[model samples]
Target: MSTPAVRIADLLEDVPTASNPPAPLPAPDPGEAPRTGGSTLNITVVWGDLTEVAADLHVTGHYQSVVPAAAELALDQAISGGSRLIIKEHTKLGWIDAQLGEVTYFPCKAGPVRSAAVVGMGPMGTLTERRALQMYASLLGEAVALGHVESMATVLIGSGTGNLAVSQAARALVRGFAGVLALLSPPTPPPRLTEVLIVEVDRLRAEQLHLALITAAESLPQLRIAPRLREESGGRLSAPSAAVYALAALARLAGPQSTPTRDGPAGTATRDGMPEGPDRPGREEALRTVLAGFDPDIQGKVREQLAHLATVDRTDLSLAVGGSVGEYDDSAQVRMSVLSGVGGLRWAALTGRATVPERLVPVDMDLLRELVNRLTEPSVEDARELPDLLSRVVVPPDFQRLLTDDARVLLELDRDTASVPWEFLAEIQHADGGRHDPLAIRTQLSRQLRTPYARVMTDALGDAPLRALVIGDPGDPEKGFQLEEARSEALAVAARLKNLGVEVSLFVGAANSREPGVDPARRLDVLRALLSGRHHIVHYCGHSDFDFSGTGRRSGWVFADGLLTAQELALLERPPLIVVANACYSALLGSATGLGRQAQPSGAADRSPWGNPQAALVPSLADEFLRLGVGHYIGAAWRIPDKQAISFAEQFYTYVFEGGPGEPAPTVGGGVRRARKGLYEQYAAGRVPPDIAPNPKRWSSWAAYQHYGDASDVLVRHDSSGTTGGS
Candidate 1:
């Protein structure tokens, strides 16, 4: 009679077993076909506990007794009285002196397998791909020598405590198995060991390994490996769905006043066909329950985005500080996470708390206030002192170390810390021992409002033509509030966007009445345009105000007719995907002039119409827009000079709409970083016009802008012809 052919297969899911202390494998069928020669060996990868797999022999790795906990320890614990039995067996057989790659076998009476083999790996944290491959090859060779071994089970050798990447470990393991198979060619009858099973407890790691094995198989066709993955129950929620759910919950928790009250059944539509607000009583709790139904780790939703950014050699460092807005407490707990990946197969995560020093405490609120005041006024002397003040106040040594050159940082802060211009935080030192550059100039850095809810949303203009609405110098020049440079900026940006195949809608104030599609910038017209949802980008170059004493109702941009408050913008049915408010104090989260006080710019009373005792600290225009589901919000943290503002807009638009060949696609964060870098370079070269940067020492307008969104967000997906250009 001929031996049965052995077949090699990789199973991506765990084998089904009946309860713990699993029953032994059923006896081989008597009516089955007799064994045949030229059979292939079967290899399976599964998501399961190693102790539960039913096999003739089990394999595990140990660190030569250097580590107390590892795969071997787990296996020992799973077997009844396994620790004492294994120790006694080893002592009796003198297997205690096993060296690296040496496997010791012992009889098993209480475990799922009839026998177990322990291989000695090197000391803890010393395992590498090469070592793992060699060890696994030796193990398989020894297992084949055991005449009665029909099946064996093992864990992913170096992926756990050994710290090897899932892909690396999987690749090494497959190659090692192949090495043993090569020794016994087709003519030689397959050994008694016809099956090997790799079990992993983590579903994600198992999935990764499944892919890696398939990838390895693609290169090794002779292996004839058939990879199979069984669908697991309870998958994760999509990023857009999770973001929408979280935002809805937040809106519900904001109280009935924030959302329109409902009179009919839940989810009923209003007169305009829009669903009633998310303000139903107990609705927030219901939403929270639904959100919890999925995996609670929200960060998993953005893994794809992080992975995409990582392809360009960028890492994401998100730091979220806990506290309410407008509360300037001495200290707050900060949660920081660093995410980076390589070759699209490996990802590294580092999570920890920000360690603040005692010497930097007692934060000088006054100094922060002065810093904002000087930056708004473009004061060179005061601006030059910012690096020292911010370093001492917020950026501690530990935090500074996290800001690596390739890091794309996002700072989520409450109102207290929000007022500080984090972009202006200087680096500790430059490689050439030159002057340190600000954080924004050195890397792609942005900020977010640290609320209990996450600010995630889907891109409204997915794969659509880029349509922009540019509103410049909305205030009439005769009224003394018009910005001449802003008028020029809007015209130039509109022309540039049009050249890049963007649908442009230009609206200039009376200052540039003849230079646009619209005669004059009107509030009603602008609102109508926004409500039409025809535009994906809104560029407002004008004056804006924030009411410190009142709610966000009074915070908005000044128009030719009146001030368009944030409350009105928030009520829009369809907000633009991106909003660029190149106006002073457009992004400020808190007031530097104290509650119930307004910081009147020198001669502001003459040029501005929106004047008053600004009320209590309220959300800025940027915050309101972001809450309204705008994908990206770019606004000024303070007053930016008109010339610098135009220059920034030009550079920013160019980076976003135009890209050179062979360069990574432009991202919102990348564009902002490039713009800032351009400005810094110009300053360094003394090329910044004197009129724009009157105080050479304070030529830091490049740091005045702030972004609030995912830095990897792509604004223009493609050009007009549907090519792969503007992604």
Candidate 2:
């Protein structure tokens, strides 16, 4: 199994036994996990660095320490828009303990394997910007495994580690995130290099990349983009191609702009070679010093990241951007990196005689092991395990929330652990949230969440108007509840955010009764951006609900065969502050099991969101949302009046943003708990019952359908002095 300097056995191994003598990377202080300063983001600069970052808004994760600041910049790339902290239980050997029972486990079935997506490369590392080019090889390799992607995008994870200059990081990312690598200038010259390296790197990188990619495209049966580039040069970086892994790395290292765009990013040097230096004068030098002279370990790290890319299964149809935040620019880099890196060698489709690697590689066995271990843990209430000590441990709700959500998990585990947003969790409510542009607030919040999740989610969004996605059609204004009401609300909200001077854009899903073509997984990219703290609220009124029957009776439930469950969602790896699903019967469901069998809610029994009081509704949408670990969601009990639904949403949103500029709602579940309390009370009193029918369990003790988590916690309840319920 030993192949080369990097052993094949070692290269393909998973993390469980793929242990390294990691120097103790202490967790940031509990309170400091959310703070920008006095936290532990400084060390990652060496482990892996984010190249194109908004310093004012982002806390560059360092492996060691974090600097403290009162009004910290929000995370740029997070799910649902901006960043929020995901607090997972990180128990080291002598350090923290994983509350097994606290986490949800999915069913272990040797199910039909689906093609993996090839997110070309966003391989985060200490490597130089050049790594982006290398990352393509790995990304392309994955494309071969994945077959294809429904759609893809990228984010930017700038390089701080490695030999990468910000300029080089930019080039690598363009090919990496957008498939559109353009020239960029450093904030300032490297302390030594007077020229902006991005200038030299961008064009050469793109041209050389185009050559390599064109050649690869020729080898491929299909492409992720227009045929123009692929049709020419017939695909070749050089007589020999740029390594797919390198191209993948370029994708990983590039800083992708996160805004949703119809046209891809293209660049030409301005009259001046390139724009360098930050708007601010003196600090540019300091930032450049850090960017250029980062620890050398980072370079090796990029190599590792690139090498890792080679092992992933790639798909032709699907294009992905791989890299940390601040490196990938957006979807373009992800798409482009695939074309440049592995499109040529990749199989045309998943159907033909796909070439398997010479080795017999199993799927991520360790992750599977972790999954099994957590799933089989003795349910807190039911203890039938051999040992009492290893019984599921109790964890706080916050940690539980992080375990369920993808954005939350990334925030909690990535190097930027210290800069994780605590305030976002505390202020997860919109007081009078109505049909206004909830996207603004959501983006704002997500900006904080994106800082660490696979690189900043919003890093690629750049300075564009916000893009929004609504369920109704834009042309047929009438017969839709989202015309003037929602649009006006959107404009007004956008204006307020304008006062704060943030960029935003909006896109809405079509109002189809079915979740048919919509891939909730695709929401990952969008959600990652929201988690970045760029988007504050994600408001949607759609017709959907969880199919609790596990039979999946509901029609048009679109999900990958292998999907995350509500239980897993409960463990928000990186929690998002505000998530609003305003529609009929729309509840989160476990993609893995179709029902939220193993997941739990963020609160107490009455407050628990797993199963309802009635076992019959075990797979109810509410339960699914709870399991999926959504932070704050507002859904209709059943079908509700559309106009009324819109009204309720608008009113609710207004309440949340009542705070002044840059002042978000408190994350301690204050706004959410408070508003929901009123809703529950009104429903209970039968005073404000809507057209929707109420389930009997709604009247029972919030704890009536409750289950206990480990004694410690498994919820996202922050330091709120609110009413507590359930067991």
Candidate 3:
């Protein structure tokens, strides 16, 4: 009986490489000049050979020697051996003169990880590195989904330059972890510039997660950002820098009307039917677009590259050395990876190999350089600072494992779980539990905060005497005061809070300053009242962006003139559900701007982040609410269809209050979620609904389906009354 690892290794050993050579020539070519003329002597020289011997045969173009890849030959031997594990002991060239010392014969059924193949930096190195990269990428999706593990790992897959690069290997590490964990988690990382993703790749930041990247690359970067960034998309990046650039490109393409494929590989050539961007500008049909501009020979889906790496054939090469053991001279070799070309035809190439006599070699130096540059192109990206928005990420079980292990602090609460941490945050302990009736007045703070309840409460509410708080657009008449109409909206919201058991008054047109930190003051006032045991709720609507430039005519809510970064928002204590009527157009438009910031993102070619609104409070509003303590926020990244917006809000409150007893609390965006179901119907009725059906014009965002606070924070469910639902 064999272990899963042995079984896996056996499967790995089955891979094939370059073609094998036919049996050694029975005799030399007649065209070959005899060595010392020592022939069989029985040779009745052919008419041409004897007649034209030396005159033409020796100097004649009668025969040509084809370059054979040594890497391919050794690879063939390993394949023939049929071992469970394959190891290639490559030099700086990733191979010996004969298959360049490539050895793939790991036959262990299962054992502690012990084998490795360190490829030097050269053509052979590059070949191995590319094979490894494609292999790692293909298995990544599955590895994450299923918490599988790989006992052995290999390394030095050409990050040292030459043909292979240390950075390129770094850029392709999906499966390397489980199948090759620790084995390749370089005890050290390469130069920061090696980060192919961002042009100005930050080495300082990525190095921190280099080791833990197997589990934390994408998640941790966003978490550690001290200042809130506008674009927080650190999606499933192979590396932090590449992820940054990939994100930048994704953002640029994520126009309000652009719908790029978020699920594809890093070098996913196209989106939907469109090319990655203007790089391959003419490709209009997304799916039909060719997969290579980076490397013409590169083909196959991400999945194929992965499988090919483990077991490829290489038998065409032949090596010959003529130098002394220690002080010898120049030698040459050839290598190739056999692959099927178009139309079920055969295709292969001399990846690299060293041979003696040098005559066996095939590729000219110039050709090898050309192939190397081409293969390395696509992975190289234009990166910059990644924003703090919630971008797409594939959080596999491995990612989960890393988080769980590193969090160091475990705290969970359920409808029935006991010992909630309500005592940590003060207001909850002393105040009359208002709208937040479901779980009792408890604060949800980071488990690490060491402050006593008294201190935290005093800090949050301040010494203000009284007055329930109300948050909403001031609706300044001078600024086109739609106060009367806006007042109606707030009043409606106030009514909803009351129905949720909030005992508070509604300041229909509350006047609070646009002063910086003013929110804390107003919120503190309400907190004081609640601590003294008053009940209250909150509601608001206006424009907002993650950054705050303070100059745009259509500026969203601004804390200060040019402040209000996302960090400030996320730091809010005990923030409540928030709703914004005039959210950014992208918020309403799902397909418009994939690039997060106001700046529109181009495709993969010239991915850039030239933020929009001419710096109008640059902070992306979506980022703010997301990071903020707001349990659930309702605001558009772009724009929402009017009817969709209205109905989204309407049914949201309806579900919360009227659903049923024991139902979950409703969230801010509950309405939108529900309304989306009827979107197509609404849109077909004259104007297409925003979120319902496909509307390439509108862009969906991380803000669209993302959630905060708790996973149990049900977006829509019946209320205790069993009729109205909750947000």
Candidate 4:
């Protein structure tokens, strides 16, 4: 028996191999006889095209469906000349509609690689690290079964348009390879595949894969991996250069239909005489043209915004506005930048102002607090103060200019401003000379808090059906904190989610006859359910408390026996993707001393620990969830009526999964906006029940809800089976 060897080699053209030596592997002992039964394996990471690699097998990923005529994959495009042959082979073998982790092999007569293996990675939206790992393991198992594979080459599977990070895919590949090797036992012959080559075309991603592979190898000493680096001409453009070329080509195509224009009103010809219509070029051309006009420094900032947008949704307008807390209690320094891509495009356009690091605009924190307080108040006088408060809120002119009627706004705010309901702010004027329409109704608005620990989860929820843990009225009625309508709300939400292909676990606090007088919302059970990491969403329709005297970490949802504090939730290693905290002040991140008085219960004021005059501003349940890496947290900034809360939840989920058979998935932000608009329209039509909202002049409960996550996040993705689930 001999030790396995692994090397990473950079295949630079005409470069001396001696300049970048491979890590030395231990020589076999002279006394040891050559083992003919189990073959020793060697692994290498190289920067080149998969088709050019000389190996027994070449592996690539394919979606569940057969490859279409117009392929979007880089590998498919690279091998376009032989793609027809591959497709024909696939059809002949009945390889259409493959399942995730399934692999099929076909001989290749046109490429350096003797044969190729195509592995199903499910749909584009459903590719995850787990699935990638499974696919890799299956590829090896199938290769071993063939018994002819001596060497193999593969692209880093799921790292391209499949939406996986390069490092993640690389790690998954390494782990999968190791897992197969570990399973080889006595009487079960080890795979004859000795050499494995990982090919990557993009220089940057290749470097990332190289590092990731080396790191993965270091963790598993049994693999005995050695690393080397080189670069060679693979006759393919790097990702950046390819992107630039594509954009240029698109611009040329778009030039004749609509010319690039200077600043002007949207949907109309600009001052530079460019026409705006349905026939105008896509967002790619518009973004490139707009970006080219900016100075290098500003362009860099705009590109940063674009990169941020790529993680969520790239087509929506992104407005990142935030500030550091100031020396004074009622004032803070603010800055803003707006990025947009009006149509389907990979790049983003700078629509508003670029952020000026040196020039921080001062904003009145008092005005923002006043706005939240006013919205919480149930008085006509307080509601009338909205226009004045909004005028004094210090929104940037650049941001104001970008606020069009049809804009899909992704608003990123700082902790100081997170509590302020920006959705209710009416920046755009109405056409009929009436009160301005709120941004929530006029535009699809979503919010993200600019926190240090917040992150966007790129991996899809695994192959399992989407799951939700719905908790309603978790507090006992004897505690004087029970929500009368919350149980029904939970049932309705669970039913709707189930209809949309989500596996829902519903828990209600009150004892029921069906359960033989047993309560389902046990604290231990709820905690275990949340920490299980199986559920994609956690919807709580009950009472929640915010600790103004503390840092808000102690604040939590009230349960049957105890409060499930934010401090406890922070311990979750795999937090749910979305959390809907439909409770009073669940999203409030400011001083709660003077807000939501009308909605508070009798003696609720006495329960507050606000006697401390030195109490500082605190984070909300939403803030804690985001900090712990929940992708989206929808919560109310103030007290919301039970009926309004139910209506909002139904509307939100309905819009989220509203897509028909083959339509594109709707965004989380879009759903929130539609839900809010539905409530506002109801109010406008005088359909509001007087008991739910007594005063027409008071700020509507619809505006109390705030979405703290990527507006572009699609919770449910449509599939070929006509069902929607978290992908």
Instruction: Output the number of the lDDT-best candidate.
Output: 1
Angstrom error at residue 33, model 2: 33
**Which candidate number would show the highest TM-score if scored against the true structure?**
1
Residue pairs clashing in model 4 are: 6-226, 8-228, 10-229, 10-230, 10-231, 11-230, 11-231, 11-232, 12-231
The candidates, ranked best first by lDDT, are 1, 4, 3, 2
Listed in order, each prediction's TM-score against the native is 0.49, 0.24, 0.27, 0.48
lDDT, candidate 1, 530-616, per-residue tens: 777778889988777654355323467766555676656655656787888777543222232232325444433212121211211
State the lDDT at 528 in candidate 4: 85
Q: How do all the candidates rank in terms of TM-score, highest first?
A: 1, 4, 3, 2
Model 4 spans with C-alpha error above 4 angstroms: 1-359, 364-367, 377-388, 428-434, 455-460, 510-519, 547-553, 586-619, 660-663, 693-699, 717-727
- Candidate 2 per-residue lDDT, tens place, 1-727, comes to 0001222332221211121111121111211211121101001111011122212112211110111011111111121122222211111011111110011111211212111111211111222233333343233222222333322121222332223434444344333322211111144221211111111112223333333334433322222223221111111122112344335323322222221111232232222133222233343343344347557788556546644543342111123222222111110110000000121111010000011122111233333223223222122221112111111121122222221111111111111111111111221223463221111111111111111112111122222333323222121222222233333333443344334332334433323322243322233443444445443344444334233344433212222222223433433344333445433322333433344523444422122121222221222333343233333333332333333344444434443434223433333222332333344345446654433333332221111111101111112221123222111
Q: Write one digit per residue (lDDT tens) for candidate 4, span 587-671.
A: 3222222234334455443232222111111235666777777778888655556667778888888767663334445657667
Scored by lDDT, model 2 comes in at 0.26
443-514: candidate 3 lDDT, tens digit per residue: 111111111111112122222222233444343333333234334454555455555554434433324333
Candidate 1, number of clashes: 17
For all the candidates, what are their Cα RMSDs to the real structure? 27.4, 25.3, 29.1, 18.2
Please report the TM-score between candidate 3 and the true structure.
Answer: 0.27
